[model samples]
Target: MGENKNIILALVLSGIILFGYQYFIAGPRIEAQRQYEALQAEQAAIEGTENAGVIEQDDAPSLPLAVSVDPQTDQSSSGNYTYADAKTIAINNAELSGSISLGGARFDNLFLANHNVELNGEEKVQLLVPANEDNGYFVRFGWTAVDASISADDLPKATTIWTSSDTELTPQSPVLLRWTNAAGIEFLIKIELDEQFMFTVTQTVNNTSGNPIQVRPYGFIDRKQEPVTDGLFVLHEGPIGVFDDNLEEQTYEDLRDADGGKFESTTSVGGWMGITDKYWMTVLIPDQAKQLAVSNLSYKASGGYRASYLEKAASVPAGGSFETQTQLYAGAKIVETIDNYQDEFGIKLFDRSIDWGWLYFLTKPFFAGIHFLFGLTGNFGVAILLFTVVVKLVLFPLANKSYVSMSHMKDAQPKMKALQERYKDDRQKLQQEMMAFYKKEKINPLAGCLPILIQMPIFFALYKVLYVTIEMRHQPFFGWIQDLSVADPVTPLNLFGLIPFDPPAVIAIGIWPILMGVTMWLQQKLNPQTNMDPTQQKIMAFLPIIFTFIMARFSAGLVIYWTWNNLLSITQQWYIMRKESARRAAKAANKA
Candidate 1:
């Protein structure tokens, strides 16, 4: 009894210590960091920093001309030039429709034709925007001078106006742009679009005026601002790419902390790199088996980030043409689309653009199984329900034994209490007697914890899949559950959308979370762990409400899966308990 009290005291102290550290230490540190970052952002904004919204890559063969298109901006580092109104060239494909700006030959204005901005809404999902606009995000393909003597004006700068041969760019029809430099170099850029979001850009230069010129082909995607992410802990929503056959992620904060706000990799091959949002990504993939310099750069001036890669320098002799091809992926990060592109284009680890995290091996298979079930059931919610049933069936034998042990322990509870009272003054003897009693009944005190230990990994893996996989995004379940990847939108405080007022997050319990809590409470009631102390019993009773509140902000699909699993557990435990009770009753009758 004394030893048990010590154990209970230790557990309670541990919980208190953990809570105290989080509330008193970690919480304040996080808030202070947030405030500092906000202050820095505000100060930078007041100072009108140059390229404040631009994200760039460093260590490229040649640096892109840093030209500011903002008229009010006075930064002279970016060449001095008058900006012109950009003429738009339309691009139409099966999956998307957008336009390219002629002013700088930038692929700007793209929208996912299939994905809606809102659930069951008609607005198309916009992915890319012009560099000068808000959140100035767009992909630009151009050349940089390998020769230091080559004038910046001789190259196609951000404000360069090029003439396009075609009015529209389509998957079947590519658009070509031509520009001439007084230094006898004629630059040709061919932009080709696939049915999806992949853009093949071929940059060619012809030395027409007889002098040999050297230049390196370069491409970059620029986002003037960071994306608004759902959450920061689980999924990566910033600079992510494949380099040298390995996956790499650099968050916005990581970039800002890097020396000079730059990171570069020169030893990369057969891989691609780019920026990724929650459900969309824009990556630059150079030709495989080719040597390329890649970099992720952050700039305070533009208040954004950019991923750029440069290919080997090409020398165009008099009457000679030099050309290079690179691919641009800008659209939804659909799992199938990304994987297919990975196999088709040989983009190494392209599928990793999704934030699979460390437990990818487990999370991926779970997602695949659930995806297969989704196909069969046609609804993710129903598929989740079926998946729970399958998992329970697989664990039936282990759970059966565990329940039996728990039942035996519950049956011995009265005897345990009597021993405790008799040995109230003898702590060591009470423990010895309790052990003997457990041995006589063949009950394992720790058996009740086994099921939870077994289920923890599966629970986390399923949560990861539901949170990170784009397949779960906008996936519908039954009524009122529109997007499984997002928290249930209808809150109980608003009477499940019947009322107009939005409640505080504390009271914003969703239907699925509430159901999960109720199921948990029911399972606890059916569980035969009656030896728990009064404190433990109260904690167990409150666990349902605590878990419901904790999971209210999680993905609805995950809550549904957990709730279904709890119900199945309750069913199994209740049945087992009834059978045990009946058997005990029959034994008593026989003795009588």
Candidate 2:
């Protein structure tokens, strides 16, 4: 009896640990995020009306070691200019639409045309914003002085307006901008784009100043303020890059602490660095053959985070010219597109931009299989269902053996109970007798847990895939499930949205979660209950309800998969239980 009780206790504890995290940790975080988003929206509306036409200055916060800074001043500088004063040049492409500011020749305003700001919304998703705004996030390129021959004034400043040869930038038609310094030195930038999100920028310097000048060319992505994050530890949502063949990921908090200081990797040969959001990325890709230093820093005065790189300085002789070509990737992180760039451009580990977690070996293949299924069906929800069926089929032999062993244990329950009662006072002897009886009946009690143990890692891997992949974001399933990446939108307390009243998160159970609970309850019925204590049986019976509450805020795709898996398990267990009962009855009749 004690031995059997220990097994029951172990199972109960496992279930509790799995569901406990949702209640004690994830539940409050979701509620806080909801409130924080609402507050941000309200603040943005107020700021738009109050701060209109005001020129917001850039933040030049202090840091420990600066990657690239103005040589004229020790402190960072923000230009005194308004959005109205700056001229904008449009970039219209099939996949991207935005404008470039002529003032700094910065690729600061960008939007993903295909991705919407919200599910089923008309407005497109914005990737880059104006430099004057509070949350000014953009990319900038310029030269850092390497020798005394070049002064800060000789380099193009953020306020320097360049003359563009073309009115607009397109995939086929590129734009060229040129500026000249006091000493007759000319700097020209030619920007080119592809059909997709890749941007090829070639910077050329013409030194006609009669004196050779030494300078280093560099580019950086800066965000004025920290953006909202989902706060899940498994997914990184800040600075990400591959330096010298090593992948480095730093969260927003980590960058904030590095303010007025420098956090950088040693000089590496062949890597790319950039800032990453949940679904989008803005990174600078240096030439793989060139040696460069990748660094991230936080500015204390401006409260901005930056990721930048500096290539080796070159000395341009008088009347000599130097030019180099680099690439910039700013768009949705679609796995296929990134992989294509990695193969064609020779960008080292570019696809590692996606957070593949520790189980990339397994998670990557799982995502690929599901993506293939989604391509055929055109519905992520349906693909998840089909994927569950395929997984169950693959594990059928192992599940079958587990269920058969469980059935044999159920058949020996009467003898086991008799032994328990006979040696009730001696706990050791009772355990010994139980083991002997299990061996005599050729039943391995531990075999029943094998399938469950195998499935746990698979479940976690699938969760990471759904959580980190952009392809799953804003995807629709059947009715009432528009975004499979988020929790089910329809809540039972609100009568599935007909009431128009938002319920608390604790009562936000959805229809799919209820169905999952029903299937779990049915599966439990098929399992042996004869040896369980009354209290343990009651606890086991309540597990389905507890899980239903725990999974209320999970992604709808995961809920659908769980419900389908439970139904399959119930069907298999029922068939095995019935078969064993009939065999026992037939043997009894033959003995009579």
Scored by TM-score, the top model is: 2
Off by over 4 Å in 2: 1-79, 258-262, 297-301, 418-437, 533-535, 582-592
* Residue-pair clashes per candidate: 16, 8
Question: Which residues of candidate 1, in runs, are more than 4 Å off?
Answer: 1-84, 148-150, 300-302, 411-443, 495-500, 582-592
Q: Write out the backbone clash pairs for model 2.
A: 61-301, 61-302, 62-260, 63-260, 63-261, 64-260, 64-261, 65-262
* Per-residue lDDT of candidate 2, residues 501-551 (tens digit): 988776788998899888888887777765566887787778788778867
Could you tell me the lDDT of residue 209 within candidate 2?
97
TM-score of every candidate:
0.83, 0.88
Q: How close to the true structure is residue 50 of candidate 1, measured as C-alpha lDDT?
A: 66
Predict model 2's lDDT versus the native. Answer: 0.79
Please write out the lDDT profile of model 1 over residues 87-204, one tens digit for every residue: 7789899998989878778787899998998887999988997665545688888776665435555777776778976899998899999999777778999988998889888989
